[model samples]
Target: MPAVTVDSTLELPRVPVPPAEGTRQRPVLSVTTAPRGFEGEGFPVHRAFAGVAQRDLDPFIHMDQMGEVEYAPGEPKGTPWHPHRGFETVTYMIDGEFEHADSHGGGGRITDGATQWMTAGSGILHIETPPEHLVLSGGLFHGIQLWVNLPRANKWNPPRYQSIEGGQATLLSSPDGGALVRLIAGDVAGHRGPGSTFTPITMIHATLRPGAQLVLPWRADFNALVYSLSGRGSVGEQGRPMEASQLAVLGGGDALSVAASARPDERTPDFDVLILGGRPIREPVAHYGPFVMNTREELVQAFEDFQAGKMGAIPAGKMPHTAPGEQRPV
Candidate 1:
């Protein structure tokens, strides 16, 4: 859960408290638990956005909370070569290392609160895996992979990548110094994060001490959501109870609120959450498999292009394999 941390919240810039008058508090419209699942080379994941209406998640496509699991030596895993189009993949590593390389010449190793943001505009081929050493000696691996959809106009924009180091995140605190806010992207109280996006969105990882409350000013045009990453907490000022792996869809408002419970689980120690919102794309979404497009015809074209090697060839000598666990070092 340590995406990023500060020695003391009091030293961070404070997020001004939303004024009581004229500011409407965002209300929790619904809360749904993310169902457990597996992803990329058989690693565990929680389908965080499962069951939520796509309309409510406009401008955002899919998200997976990857492993809060501890892996034994030689047990860590990652995805083989894959293709994507018409969206961006934002991978934030909370506690472990992940190596990413794409056919378009974007690659890097991210770990311990760092982030790798990849835009699959038009199309591209890529792979995500644990570095060789991490695979040889498995350790804690936890992270988030969020799929942000591009609008129809920018669907075919050139692909891009951003490797935002953990320290590059904009750190802030709640008015009372009871919560730590790690702004990974977009603007919060005019404070900006490192990652850039085709679509306007805000991504934040926040941790609250037991019984602490955090209120943040939110853009009225953007749709809001609060996903609990660990421990117990409440969403909205009215205090709708939420627990680990739960996703809360919030209704329109000028601001949002989250509060940690007085008694949190011993395992997590604090209430951790991901606060996300984006300007609604509000277009006809025709998503299938790895392609997010505006029409079925476009999706078909995407597959055809990928099969024809139009996306980009894998770098010389790269081959699809399960993981280093299958080929241990001597």
Candidate 2:
């Protein structure tokens, strides 16, 4: 929960309150709780986008809320070397540290509040793992990995990477000085974040003090969603209950709101949420284990190309160190 913060919200620039009369407050369409699961190398994760309709999540293929768990010494784990195509992977590290390396020469360390954005456009091979020291002396590890679907036209663009440091995010406050909004990508109220995106989208991590409300003017063309990261809260004017690991898909409107309950869950003192929206791609989607494409034929071709080594080769002497008893990928 210490992704980014300020000693006092009163010191930050304020997000102006939307006019009440002219703007429509988005209604909550549905609220779903993420089911727990284990991800790469047996790390815990919550499948945040589960049970949501594909149309509603268009331009966003999948997401996983990787552990709010505290790990003991020698227990940290990460993904094996894998190939991906036709999409982008955004890894935001909220607490612990993760190291990323790819076949296309894109690699970096993403730690506390930083983000590593990798566009696996066309095709690429990559690996994400806790650093050796973190592996030896385990600590809290929490983060999110979101898969952003690329439009058919841009799916084949050359691979690229961006390392956005924690302090790079645009920080703003609620007019009442009750919330802190960290803009990681896209524009909000004419203020832009650091990460550039192929798809038009906005990603914000906002924290609201107990009983505080955060309202933002939203783009009418983009679909909106709010996912609770910690504590208890409510979404929309109707006051749909929201808690940790719950996602609320909002109906069409000119603005959106989220409020923390006066009595938040004991786990956290404030309610934190991830608010995101993107212009719908509105194209057919064919997704598999690691590839997202517009058609089954393209997915098949992606696998063939990957197996044929067209994605790129592992760097010399830099093969990922496999865990004991873990099988190596072919």
Name the regions of candidate 2 deviating beyond 4 angstroms.
322-330
Question: What does candidate 2 score on TM?
Answer: 0.97
- Residue 192 lDDT (model 1): 96
TM-score of structure candidate 1: 0.96
Model 2: per-residue Cα lDDT at residue 252: 96
lDDT of 1: 0.90
C-alpha lDDT score of every prediction, in listed order: 0.90, 0.91
Per-residue alpha-carbon lDDT of candidate 1 for residues 1-330, written as tens digits (9 for 90 to 100): 677788999999999998999999998899999999998778999999999999999989999999899999999999888889999999999999988888888898989999899999998888888988988998999999999999999989999998999999999999889999999999989899888998999999999999999999999999999999999989998999999999999999999999999999888779999999999998999999889999999999988888777888677555445332242110
